[model samples]
Target chain A: MSNEVVLKFHKVQKKFGDFTALKDVSFEVKKGEFFALLGPNGAGKTTLINCLCGLTDRTSGEIAVLGVDPEKDPVHTKLSLGIVEQEVNFDPFFTPMEILRLRRGLFGLPADDAYLEWILEKLSLTDKKDVRARQLSGGMKRRLMIAKALAHDPPILILDEPTAGVDVDLRNSLYDFLRELRTQKQKTIVLTTHYLEEAELLADRVAIQNLGETIICDTTKNLLGKKNRTLVIETCEDEEVRVEIDNNSLDLESIVANYPHVKNLRIHEPKLEEVFLEFTKNPKS
Target chain B: MNFKRYSTLAWKECYRFLKVWTQTLISPVIIAVMYFAVFGGALGSRITEINGIPYALFIVPGLVLLQSTTNAFMNPSSSLIIMKYSGTLSDLLLPPLSALEKTLGYMTGGIVRGLLVSTLIFAVAAVFTGKIVPHDWGVFLLMLFLANGIFTLLGTILGIWAKTFDHISGFSTFVITPMGFLGAIFYSLEMLPPLAQKLSLFNPFFYLADGLRYGFLGIAEVDVKYSLIASGVIFLLLFAANFWAFRTGWRLKL
Candidate 1:
């Protein structure tokens, strides 16, 4: 268990005055594992990430990333981690390429021109690298954000709302780049996204949080499997309905007899979106 | 943790102000000269010398202090606000740099801008009226740095608190400008009644201006020692506040 742990939260909590943004929540990201901190808005997915990044202080408990305390050893911890914030803040005065150059200098990391070119090329930001950040479109800005986070080449990458307000092509391109990072760079990714399908596609484990508590933490299959055996039926007068039922409670014969128009009966794997909704509905862990 | 990173960031910040000199650096210097030429030159001649220095010379130090204060405060404050507004501030914050590094980076920009404007005003003042103050390079530099440091902190705090463009300007107009005018910048605190002079002692900017004037003219309405101690104390307090805000990820990152 210790060998695989990349990040561990021991009952971490955060409170803004009276409102607890994150309850006594704890979770782990295994080494090199693609993980997701999934939740709805204000559900505390970003709150947990903020605590890990030292952007927000935790009211209770401890957080260790890469064997360093996030609060006490933020510099060392930050060296091993990269975070893409939910909100965007770029230097309007500097061009995209200049920003990356400045960031590289700030980190005291030597410029690997080859890697820089490769990232810019892959993210489709090469052309606009010369243009100031303010001139770029929203999606372009998001793409440049990812590129900046990637520039340091940290072992852990945390993307918060990475694909927000992005066009489909750019989203696909970014995903392809991330998938490459996950596979080739040995980079552990903590993806906080509203798109469940993206999580299902990339995250090795998905943790759904609600009201500051983690409601579910398991592999994508195991979590999605619990809500399988959905029953979609067409009743009398061409009436149609859908239901997700437990396999134990489902009687195929009874279902078919009750609704004869449900002729195209078949079993399909559960979608991650359905399970996410159910996970969010319950607040208490 | 590494001090070199702060140096690098600070260098970058300095370069930024210099690169956009026309706006951040030059405009303020030109404005400072214009104020001296129009007000100090035209009106100061009619005015008699005070405290063994010409009226024009007497007013130059405080006016320069005024420019440095505004520039120093505005440089860092506007830097943070621009990053917040234009969505690019993340460039510096997300890295391994310590909070002190980031804080120093922004503060250094303000310091440089303030010093540059202050120097330009000094040159223009020398041409407009000989040796604006007697001479004390060491104390002059000290008071200028202290004033810049204090107002830079003020600007940074205002920037953090401000959510919109007008918010920053509003603070500058309603608070900073009023404080500058009333801090005995153009008038001697000694001219005020006993109660008014006592009240002006409470103004930190007054100490800043008085201490700076003492360096140039060797005369001040208040004790130079008291002005030095007050300005020094304000600088340290503001530095602590700025560093704390930086460490807490205050509104800078959020």
Candidate 2:
């Protein structure tokens, strides 16, 4: 991936009336990077997304999408970004094909039936292409949102809780599709999701935001590596115990010698969820 | 400034009403026909002439203006309110469209709906009165365009301001409907006493109806030149207001 920044938030602050939604938040997403922004409810994720998309104004600080400030050049900035919002906001009366055609026209892009057909097929929405959006199921609606976002073939795609309420099968397929977008298509993706496991599986780098501020930002491997290694041991007495050990001190020979009655031993690396919970649950950390 | 984007937005707005022609187009046409049947048929002979023109002929222009203006106001207001409520407005907002493009796109829908309703009214009037010709076709078309443009802008403002269905209905009920009736659609302002005629001057709709009437019948209570100027000023003001609203993202952006 190129080191060039695709998105940058420099000490951004967003205030609604007297209440601040984001407080001195700053981060940068590199080109062709699968970046995950994890936060609990009301962690300013949506507010941040809104500000990035020009749907909401920032109280202070600067944001640039592909080096273009959205505030200064919203139309041009929006042309490079595609957002799959948390809600299904499509026109109810329009069919999937009709909506895509309309979106393509809105972006001033020429019609390419092959691309449209490929997007529909990838999202498993081929059969529902002619059906009104409102008639589609919840999962289908979510996929339709993705399809609409991809319609313009924007360079950067931001998915705000794309898999919320989505079935496992569809979610897995979407994950695969997103991976392909990052790997084969070299598209930069910024995702905000409540599903930590999904983020752990997909995100190359993850940022945890809490109480409207980003507390931690690092690569997924580095973040997970911060926590100590865990060892789960099973003994002949049919007893199981989990012990936390320093990563460097985790030696299988030493562990077996220490627990002679051990029947089986397994080393466990801390999952992303553990690190996320640790960072968010303790704000001062 | 992209023609393709502007045209697409405009086409979508037009397509929305066209797709629901039964409610948007046919219903208004039916209501207009009923008005002519009741007002023009039942009372035509008794109230023979209004301002030197036959009562039936006089009301044709007024009814046409009334339907067109109401439609022009309702189209954008309801479209915006519905999109706002259904959370579908983000579709338009997320696009690379400029505020001016969005404003013109929405206004196009209202303009098209207004013209469609006006044409239907004229068609129905032709069948009944057998005379659909105008004194000055240029003035007639100009008045029609200006009148629709004014209401379409008003609807856009109300659509942005309104938060609920009741708010939109209330605007139509308390504001637009009363203004239409008081604008002298059924009778001439000259028929009223001196004081009432003076009070009628305060009504903006009066200018629209009077200007439209003068276009068709070649006679009006107000000076056509002054009415044209006033209509032009009002159109510019409404356009400016809508432009400002979109630019500031009033009630549209968070």
Candidate 3:
């Protein structure tokens, strides 16, 4: 990934009447990077996305997509990035092909049937392109949303829970598609999802937000490396015990020596899931 | 503004109504024909004449205006409300199309539907009254656009403001429908008492009906010049209001 920041949010805050949705959000995603935004329910993930996409106004702060502020230049920002909103927003009356064509025109892009067709094929929506969107299944609709986002072939892709209700198989296929987009197409991706495992598998870097504030943000490798590792000890009596220990602070040799009757012993690297739980569960820590 | 994008949005608006021709086109014509049959045929016999034009012929322009007005108001309002409720409005909101383009695109749908209904009603009215052409084609076309433009933009504004289907229907029923009826669709300003006539002058729909009536019959109770100017001003105001609504993302953006 290039060092240049493709997306940036500096002290973003949003308020709805007396209720604040985004308290203080700030982050940056580099070009060609797959950045995941993970948060619990009501953590202002969608609110932040709304502010970034110009769907809503932020009460205070700045957001820039490739140096163009969305508030000042919404058209440029909209043209630069394609967003798959958290909800299915396609018009059911329109066919996939019609919707895509309309979207292409809306973005002020030249007509390219071949490109749109390729997008359909990439999302496995080729056969369903001519059918009305309402008739499509839930997974198919989700994929169609992605296709619509890619209609303009934007440099950046921001998917807000793209696989919320999708089945495992389709979700896996979407992951592959997203990976291809990042790798082959060199598209910068900013994803917000409830599925931490999805983030773990796909995101190069992740940010965890809770109560409208970004609690932690770092590379997956760095975050996992910083977290305490787990040590599992299995005794000859078929009893097993797990202990959390920092690799640097705890002496592994001394811990292993304490288990003399151990039949099996293994050291486990902390998973992103555990790290996410820890940070969100105790953000102050 | 990109012409291609604006034209595409306009085409999409047209496509939306055309996709449901039975409700948008045919139903309005059927209702217009029914009104002509009941009001023009039955009522015309007793009324004989209005403003020196045959009663059936006098009511023809009013009938056309009435359908055009209702359809023009309903088209954009329902289109907007449905898109809002379904969350499909983001497709338009996220696009790079300018606010002016969006306003014109949506207004095009309502104007087209209104004109189509007017044409259909005029054709049907011609069969009964035997007048296919208007007295003044320029005035006819101008009134058609001004009246249609005013209501269509009103619908666009209401569509953005309305949160539910009830809000749209309620406004149509309580405000638009009552205003249209009191605007002299069935009778002339001279037919009413002096107080009612004064009240009729206050109704914007009265100017619309009178202006269109002058176009069809070359006769009107009120001066057609004032009606033309008033309708033009109203149309421009509504157009600006809609443009401002889209530009500011009023009620559309969170």
Candidate 4:
């Protein structure tokens, strides 16, 4: 990812009547970055995305997709961004080819049948292109939504739990597909998913939101590196305890003094899941 | 401004109804045939002719207006609420198309459906009455265009305003059907009492039906020019209202 910021949110706040959904959320995503927005349910992750897409108006603050304010020029904002919502929302009556044809027209692109066919092929939907969306299996429907989002080839793609009901094999393949898009096409990707492992495995930068606030935003390596290593000690009595290591320093004498009957010792590195829980579980920390 | 996007949405709406041809097109024609059988066949015997034209022939224009306008209204109304509830509205909303473009696109579906149904009903009317043709083709086309444009735009407004299927059905059952029945379709103003004749002046559907009848027979109870002006005004008003609803995203964007 380069220093060029392709998407940005500045203190974005959204309220539905008396309840605030997004409170003081601010972040920037650089071009070609795989950014994961990690948050608990109702933590304003989707709400923030809605604001960015101009689907819902924000109560306060600003959002810019590729240097253009979405509220000011929603047409331009939508033209530059492709969003896959959480639900399967393609028209059930239309076939995959018909849906893509309209999507291409909506983006003001020429009716390039060859390109659309290629997208269907890449997504493994070419076989099912002529079938109505309602007849497709759940996995195929999900894949069709992905194909629709990629139809226009927008520079930035935002996926909201794209692999929610996908099978394990399909999920792994989707991950590979996303990786190819990011590496080969250099498309900036923003993903929000319940599966922390997907985010950890794919994202270069992570932003954790809790209770309508962004608690932490940093690179995956930095967030995980900031966490201290653990020293797991096992006693002869089969008791086990953990000690936090600071700055990679381990005082063997102090550890031996503390655990006089130490039978085993091992060091453990924190996973992104652990780091994510630490921030969300205790936002103040 | 973007004709491609607008035409795409228009065709999408058309394809949606066409996909369910049994429900959208064929069913409405069947219902109109039933109306022609019951009203024109049974009732025309009692009232032989009204104003030199056969009773069945006189009711032809009204049935055409009814089927045409009703289908036009239902096309956008039901399609939109269904899309909204099913969450497929995002397909139209997330794109770069402008509100005006969306409005025109949906309106195209309604107008096309309206005209198609009207053509079929006219054919059925011809079979019963023999070779129906417009006495004033210009006025016939004008009345059809105006009625379709008006109701289609009204449907667009109600589609965005409606929150549920009930909202759409409620308006159709309560407001549109009543107005259509009382709109001088089945009877002329002269057949009613003097007070009722005066009251019919306020009904827009009366103007539409009367205008259509004038186009078919070159005769009308009221001044054909008045019907023309009223229908034109209603179309413009609804078009402006639809444009405003789309621009503000009134009930749609939230």
Q: Which structure among the candidates has the greatest lDDT?
A: 3
Q: Candidate 2 clash total? A: 0
DockQ of each: 0.47, 0.81, 0.83, 0.80
In model 4, the Cα lDDT at residue A203 comes to 95
What TM-score fits each model?
Answer: 0.86, 0.97, 0.97, 0.97
- Docking tier of model 1: it is acceptable
Real contacts recovered, all predictions: 0.62, 0.74, 0.84, 0.81
| TM-score of model 4 vs. true structure | 0.97
Error of 1 at B20 (Å): 4.3
> lDDT score, residue B221, model 3?
77
lDDT of 1 by residue, B30-66 (tens): 8888888777878887877777778888888888988
Highest DockQ: which candidate? Answer: 3
TM-score of 2: 0.97
Look at candidate 2 and tell me the lDDT of residue A43.
Answer: 94
Q: Note each model's CA RMSD in angstroms.
A: 3.9, 1.4, 1.4, 1.4
Instruction: Give, for candidate 1 chain B, the lowest lDDT window spanning 10 residues.
Output: B85-94
As for lDDT, the candidate ahead, 1 or 3, is: 3
Q: Could you give the CAPRI-style class of model 3?
A: high
Score chain B of candidate 2 by TM-score.
0.98
Ranking by DockQ: 3, 2, 4, 1
Clashing pairs in 2: none
lDDT of 4 at B129: 91
Model 4 lDDT per residue over B1-254, tens place: 79988998899889888999888888888988998898899999998888888888889999888888889999999888988988987786788888789889989999999999999889988999995679999999999999988899999889988999899889989989999999988887899999999888999999999999999988798999999999999998888888888777788775
Report how far off residue A61 is in candidate 3 (Å). 1.7
DockQ of 2: 0.81
Q: What's the i-RMS for candidate 1 in angstroms? A: 2.2
Greater-DockQ candidate between 1 and 2: 2
